[model samples]
Target chain A: MKRFRVLDIVLGILGLLTLLWIWHLVTMLELIPRVFLPSPAATIAALEWGLVNGDLLPQTLATINRMIQGWLLASLVAIAVGSLIGVSAIARAYIQPTLEFLRPLPASAIIPVAISIFGLNSSMVLGVVVFGAVWPTLLGTIHGFAHVEPRLVEVSRLLQMSRWEFIYKIGLPNAVPDILAGMRLSLTVALILAVVGELLTAQEGLGTAVLHAARSYRAADLYAGILLLGLIGLVSNYGLAIADKRILAWKN
Target chain B: MAQNAAIELKDVSLSFGSNEILTGIDMSVEPGEFVCVIGASGSGKTTLLRMIAGLLPPTTGAVLLHGKAVRSPTRRVAVVFQDYGRALLPWRRAYANVSLPLEASGMPANQRPARIRQLLAKVGLANHEDKFPGQLSGGMQQRLQIARSLAQEPDTLLMDEPFGALDAMTRQTLQDEVLRLVAERKTTVFFVTHDIEEALYLGDRVVALDSNPGRVAYDIKVPLPRPRDQLTTREHPEFLRLRREMFEIMNKIHA
Candidate 1:
């Protein structure tokens, strides 16, 4: 394990160096104008300027807060509804068609409808993100809950576990891996909707930053915003991966 | 006369959809009797055992435990399946697995620890109390399953090819342990297997079941005395004779 970690670190460093080298080459070649494709140094300067002068920190905070609210609310609703449907054939029969119909429709397509219904504010953005994120979570919860081993179910019945005990002990634990996988997918979907929501509807956040930089023809600022978003995505995914490993440590 | 029968199946018939698995099966297990049901694959041996365990309902007739009808798995009956890995809950420790039925029966939490310890020691898994099922070997896992079932202090123990997956040496050792344990506890056991030798070796009565609507082809009494050891029992003339007769019967059924 120690040797593998060392090798991983070395490979990561080499990959970073190669990326920097390519970035330098691309800038020097002037294949695209600097205003359209800024150098890494220029992008860094723009990032610093935004951090110092613009409403970057507050807007970033607002975006994160909205994302958390929407994501969490959607997750709770999905789990409750999905579990109900998973446990009951009639409930699934009634709800499945509606869910399937809505799931395939692009969440962005409903942004205009959200704006009209919730007004041109954070609620609209939240609506979009929640709509996009909930499907994966709901589907995952249903699939996970439904796929619990029949043998385990028999065991639970034989043991005379209460309804709640059956769910909490056998059902939930068995479905956890699937639930986590679904949440990971939902997180990515939430991030995408967050950016799209801000870009299309709001006057602030990282998405708005990209739009403003694009309008002003400031490529360096645009690249900086995009870089920050990418970093956020990488960090969120890494955090989830760590959590998944810890939770499923019992699994072979 | 009726008090001695731990379990009874009268004209028990079982079917899956249109295909009948067991038909007109009549059997009774006396108190503390070790009965082994042996047959070929697809022979309704397992189906019959499951009916007795109350895991499956008979298509027709009744499965009775202590004279009451068995519509579902009774608290006094417990089963140990062949797949030890799948039989145990992975999330629980060895001690927890043993105590699971006690807890389910709503045994007081304060008294659970003592019971778990006693059962673990009985199964020779005292040191493994803290270990999870995944950490145990195939043999150890089987022992854990046995411990868990025995913890229930059941009126009858139902095993479906319990040691069928183990190595020959491990299987032999476990068979000895099981016989010894059953003798000590005086627990009635209804064990099922495809191995003819295993049936003869462990059972007080070896029931040979034939397939195609499975029913008992023959019921042979094993004449070996109690507290029989592996070497001595195998060397006994009666044991050899019974084994050969069972092998022939099984072969004829298969053919």
Candidate 2:
């Protein structure tokens, strides 16, 4: 594993170097203007300047806080409602059409309405993120619970396990992998919605930094902010993947 | 011996959506009696065993345990299903699977380890206790399932084709081991099988069932002596006679 990680890092460095070389060649050939497409060095310099002089760190923190709160609240509600629907056929039949009606409406489409209701605040950002993140988690919970092996359920019942015991022992354990996969997917969607929310209405955050740079024609700063957003997304996804591996180590 | 009748079924009948599976099933098993129920596929042998284990409800009649009707599965009656791979939980180690019944019984935590060890040792799986069912071979996994059922200290054991998935050699060996263990524990067994030879080999009394609304077609007693070995029991005159009789009964049922 250590050898593999080292090899991955080496390959990554080579890939980055190749990209930089191509960029240098393109810029020297005047394929794009310096104002339109800043070099990597210029972007780095802009990143350092933003980190030192602007409220970049604070805005990043604010974005993260809203994302976490929205994602967690949405997950809790999704699991509760999804599990209820999973166990009861009548409940599923009654609620499924309404959920279907609501799920497909894009979270981004709700931004204007949220801005009107919450007045361009964190609440508006949170509302959009929650709307985007909840559906995958809810569908995951429903699928997980609905597909529990009937034979295993019979075995548990034959053991004279209580309803609570059946849920904890057989139900929850079987559903963990599916639930985690949903969570991972929802987290990615939540991150996208967070940036979208900020870009649409917020006066702060990396999205705001990017928008400001664009308006002022600071191409380097815009590129740097976009890079930072990409890095955050990559880190979040990798972190969730590591967590999933650890929890489901028993599986192949 | 009469006082040791662990289970009794009085006109026990089972139907699924108007199709009668088992009808007019009356049988009594004494404590420690290894009674094997043999029939063709879909003959309701498994259903009868499930009813005895209280995993299935008899539609019209009742299954009695110690003179009381059994409404649901109780710890006193445990079943080992044919699918050993599916029977044991994959996430749990062999010892944990064996200990599941004890855990469900809510036995104090302190005593569980010792009980699990005892049962695992009994099933000759002491060395493989830490391994999961996936890690073990088919025979080893089935042994683990047997150990799990035995951990409940059940008065009656209902095994539905427990050795059916095993190779012929492993099946015969496990059959001998199961018989020896059953003899030691003196637990009443309702062993279901489609194999006439296996039924005759392990049973104190072999009950043959006919297909299509399965009913007991014949009951033959094995007069072979106790502590019988594989070779000696197969060579015994009574064993051969019983095997022939069961085969004829099955042949006629199919006809």
The C-alpha interface RMSD of every prediction is 1.5, 1.4
What DockQ, between 0 and 1, does each candidate earn? Answer: 0.46, 0.56
Q: What is the per-residue lDDT of model 1 for residues B22-66, given as tens digits with 9 covering 90 to 100?
A: 888888888899999998888888778778877788889999987
For candidate 2, give the DockQ: 0.56
Residue-level lDDT for B112 in candidate 1: 95
Show where candidate 2 strays beyond 4 Å.
A1-25, A52-54, A112-119, A201-203, B1-4
lDDT of 1 at A149: 77
List clashing residue pairs in candidate 2: none
Candidate 1 colliding pairs:
none
**Cα-based TM-score, every candidate:** 0.91, 0.90
Candidate 1 per-residue lDDT, tens place, A73-109, comes to 8888888777767765677678888888999999988
Find the candidate with the highest lDDT and give its number: 1
